[model samples]
Target: MNTVKELFRGNIRQYGMVIALLFIMVFFQILTDGILLKPLNITNLILQNSYILVLAIGMLLVIITGHIDLSVGSVAAFVGAISAILMVDMQMHFVPAMLISLLIGALVGAWQGFWVAYVRIPSFIVTLAGMLLFRGLTMIVLDGKSIAPFPKTFQKISSGFLPDAFGGKIHMLTIIIGIVLSLILVFSEWRKRSTQQKYGFEVGSGALFALKLAAMVAVLNIFTYVLATYEGIPNILILLFVLIVIYTFVMNRTIVGRHIYALGGNEKAAKLSGVKTQRITFWVFVNMGVLSALSGLIFAARLNSATPKAGVNFELDAIAACFIGGASASGGIGTVIGAIVGGLVMGVMNNGMSLVGLGIDWQQGIKGLVLLLAVGFDIYNKNKGVS
Candidate 1:
């Protein structure tokens, strides 16, 4: 019990943020007269935030590695334009076009990575240049036109929902998926606890662990139920889920993940320790490019078109999500789950404000204040520790 309390004491910030998220949800749920968590609204929430969440996952890593990619939004727009040109203008298949676009994105990553990791340029400058470069390239590719009315198959990527094989009003598939995921969550938590105890590492108590697991199961089941009542699940939700799980593993359970943390903690030290700082840094941007490209496709599909202005301010959004999720301003900290939660915070606020018919003017101001407070909170805690 004491160990569990100690764990909570150490991670008060993360848990506090989670509590804040819940508080906001409940507040909005009441303010909107229960429209906030309606089945339809819940589905829309996932779909709306799916692309940003994807970017957040990548941004989390880049920030952790002590860098930022200002070019992701432009990269997404450029790749999305290329996808439209291939599929619509040239009448190519979406799958092949998607593959090609992803490759191009990777190459773009490699290009910027070369400048940052090898040539020793600052990331902000490199990606800022990349942001302009890709935006210009997107306009040139599309001739400043918005390509629209994608094929049914392409549109399905964003708008399609999983079909219920059971054919009942209650989404049996969603519930089943929820059950499977809950079981996995339980098993993983138990194994992790056992391993930590075996190694004499500090761990939350078994009861705390159980309670957390129970919460996870409950939330998963509830979210699944919400979707089950509506369209079962959005296809993009699956993509986001896969990404979150993969990234969570990569950051928590892999050697590369450890190396990233090391580099972020102290670049010179990590290099002396043989962390291959350059290689890791180079690959980080490459990964960002790939995700940007993927997001471009998803965003374009959702809109049913590729617009020249498709990705305006997307980088800002991604950066905000990372920082709001508790990523340090100086980097070397943050988590995949934190990024997701942060993005959701942004998404929910955007949604709730819109539901209340607030103007864009007020929305932007409120959001800005939230971001400021979030970062401010982190800075306060940081300084307090030193004091």
Candidate 2:
């Protein structure tokens, strides 16, 4: 009890946002007359927000580097349009077309990175120009019209679910997978804690650790159950899961990750310390491009079409997710999990408002309000010198 209290006292904002997410979920689950958590709706929510979550991961890195990419939305749209032209118009194989689209995305990132990292242009200016450039290119590629009905194989990337080999209506595969994942997660945490203790690193109390572990395991199983009752897991969910794990590892454990934090914390100081600031910044943007491209592909697959407006306001959503997830505005602080939870918050708000029959006008207003409050809270905390 004391340890849990200490943890909260030191890091209330992170846990607080998490609790707030739960509260929002409950509120919507009730306001929608339980429709929000309906098996089908849960699946829809995953599909609807997967791309945003992907964008958020890359956005987190960019933010931690004390820069922003305003063109991810436009880049994604451009990539989607290119993908459609390659696959549908040119009749190229889906796999090769995807590679080509990704390559284009990387090239675009390199282009922006060159300006920001090498030429010393502000990221804001570079990506803003990219926003306009790619948007125009998307229009040109699609000829200012929507492309449609991608090959079934491409569409399956977003809509398909894993086959249930358990051969039961309850999705035994899902349940089994859930249980195994939960156990693995818990065991991994335990081992990590043990290792930390051996190294004399800071470790939380057993009681607090147990409490946190149980909650996570429970949520894992419950979420799995919800999906199992519907149609098992969407393929996008698998991709999202893998992405989350990989990014979390990179951010928490890698030297590059530490360098990014150093740069965001104090760029001049990091450079003085012999960090390759320019190269790091350049690669960060390149990584952002790759992610934006992947998201573009997923978004196009979901819609079965590409349009000039396919990525409208996507950058804003990704940025907002990072801020709402407890990222510091000035950078040097954030977690991949926080960004994901933030994306979920954004997704829930959109879903809940629509379910309650709010007009599009009201939805936008409400979303804007949420973004304002989130950033405002962060600014307040920083001023107060809270962790």
Candidate number of the best TM-score: 2
Candidate 2 TM-score, true structure as reference:
0.97
Per-residue error for 283 in candidate 1, Å, reads: 0.6
**Residue range with the least summed lDDT across 10 consecutive positions in model 2:** 1-10
lDDT of 2 at 221: 99
Residue 212 error for model 1, in Å? Answer: 2.2
List, residue by residue over 1-387, the lDDT tens digit for candidate 1.
677666666785677578778988998898899999999999999888888989999988899999999999999999999999899899999999999999999999999999999999999999999999999999998899999878889988999988888987888998899899889988988898888899998776667777888888999899898899888988988888889889889998899999998989899999999999999999999999999999999999999999999989888888888888888878788888888889999999999888888999999999899899988988887887721
Which 10 successive residues of model 1 have the least lDDT summed?
Answer: 4-13
**Which ranges in model 2 have alpha carbons more than 4 Å from their true place?**
none
Q: How many angstroms is residue 151 displaced in model 1 relative to the true structure, after the best TM-score fit?
A: 1.3
Clashes of each: 0, 0
Candidate 2 residues 54-159, lDDT tens each? 9999999999899999999999999999999889888999999999999998999999999999999999999999999999988888888998879999998999
